[model samples]
Target: MIKNIMQKVMALACSFIFSTGLAFASTQTAVTAQLVKSEADGTVLICQYRTMKKIHFKVLFTHQVCPLAIQVGH
Candidate 1:
């Protein structure tokens, strides 16, 4: 009767809601990783570093090897 039709409609409505929620839950966000800095020849490589994903800030760091270790005197 009408109850059967309403039952089906309710089921469909619930399924639609659930499916859309799942789609949003499974949404993919593209995160990019780029080489931020580097030294000549060979030294250090800085990268992703928490990637600023869901975070509001980025981290910066420097690495030196072999040469450039000495701080210039005043």
Candidate 2:
């Protein structure tokens, strides 16, 4: 029937669109922004260490919040 053919055509078109979108998305590259160090830091080593510690603390806090948030969420 005409309806059946149209349904198949629409489904094929949707699949093609989704496939192309995913392909384009995967081809995109990730961009990372580096932070600029201030003069007070004195050296690059100290600046890197400070940034590492801050990142560590943030990750720890985020992990710790997950459990408490899950309990409250439920």
Candidate with maximal lDDT: 1
* Global lDDT of model 1: 0.45
- For every candidate in turn, the CA RMSD to the true structure comes to 14.4, 13.8
Summarize candidate 2's per-residue lDDT along 1-74 as a digit string, tens digits: 99999999999999999999766764244323233332232222212112322321112322222111111110
lDDT of 1 by residue, 1-35 (tens): 99999999999999999999766753353443333
Error of 1 at 30 (Å): 16
- The alpha-carbon root-mean-square deviation between model 1 and the true structure, to one decimal in Å, is 14.4
In candidate 2, the residue pairs with backbone N, CA or C atoms under 3 Å apart (3 or more residues apart, or in different chains) clash, namely: none
lDDT of each: 0.45, 0.38
